[model samples]
Target: MLKAGEELDMRINELKKYDTITIDNLKEIIDTHLFLTNVFSDISGHNNRSLASKYLHFHVPNMFYIFDSRAIQGAKSYVMSDKQLRASLAPFGDKEYIELVIRLFTFQEHVKSQFGMTVTPRVIDSFLLNY
Candidate 1:
């Protein structure tokens, strides 16, 4: 527990250097999420991607996109059904968490252009959850 807290503290400090999420800083954001997931997974002996992402999202809501089975399925479904989205999305690679962030960023832009309203990560999560 002590080690886990220390690891989290260190990651939080690293994350504090970033003021916001942007295409330029996205790699660092994803690296932070992967680092936290590995840290907790090492301590807990379970896959911690979802938990790590949720925790990071709590601290940096605008920067980190929450990941879970439901949201993954929703994103997959939505992307598959939208022709323009399929063409626009970058090809997914081995890092699925990175793919999710890219998808969410693209989806956010799509929504803003289609509806003339900007949405946050939380709003995107809600849409995915209810999709």
Candidate 2:
């Protein structure tokens, strides 16, 4: 697990391996996310978070999160549609909405520490759309 205030640079490097990203990568992201409903609810799975490598595959590499209405609000300025909002979440099964808020807030903290900007999820989604 990530420690409080751990450096995100190294983590970013690791995440890049699976980052075959593009504006059109949403299709892949959507497909990947759609699998979560069955996967997360399963009692057992090889790619589950009980394993370190598997956990990273789910979170770090995919850069995906469960749903949060607040995150949708934060992403409002970036994506204009509910569709785009839905797309960003296309990677996780149903999760406690607060977890999204916490995870996203942590991401915002990482960005502020590294780049000195307090970006909302909207800014993040905008970047990902073009990234």
Candidate 3:
């Protein structure tokens, strides 16, 4: 377990090298942290997606999102249109995740530029939840 923890730590450290994660670098990051691919199952009678999201978000807030139904809906509505989001979803892979991050970053930049609202990723996430 200590070795696993150390490996995870190193993977996270690799992620830290990116000032802003992009499609170009996302694969290497995810490849290192392969555990990120685990989806929730009811076998444990627990919401593992939420658990894992919180865990990863706690570590890399700017690069990850916790997408339950509401969050996914919110992300759909947060963008200009569903079609735009759908278009972005193509060739989905690690690229899709990076695109989501890019969308959030773009949304943050848009808000800052248009509304003069400087916000953190948490605030942006809240906006996604509420928007």
Candidates ranked by TM-score, best first? 1, 3, 2
lDDT of 3 at 7: 70
Worst-scoring 10-residue span by lDDT in model 3 = 33-42
Give every collision pair in model 2.
33-90, 33-91, 74-122, 75-122
| TM-score between model 1 and native | 0.73
* lDDT, model 1, position 2: 79
User: Candidate 2, residues 1-131: lDDT per residue as tens digits?
Assistant: 24311433354444446543333443343334334333443535443322322333345544443243444455444333334444464454233332333345455556777899766444654554454
Give the clashing residue pairs of candidate 1, or none.
none
lDDT of 1 by residue, 21-110 (tens): 555666667777877777777878987888888998898777787898888887776653434433333242126676677777777767
How close to the true structure is residue 55 of candidate 2, measured as C-alpha lDDT? 38
Off by over 4 Å in 3: 29-34, 37-47, 80-120
Q: Tell me how far the alpha carbon of residue 86 in candidate 3 is from the true structure, in angstroms, after superposition.
A: 9.5
**Candidate 1's C-alpha lDDT?**
0.72
- Select the stronger candidate by TM-score from 1 and 2: 1
Q: State TM-scores per candidate.
A: 0.73, 0.34, 0.57
Instruction: Please report the candidate that would top TM-score against the real structure.
Output: 1
Candidate 2 backbone clash number: 4
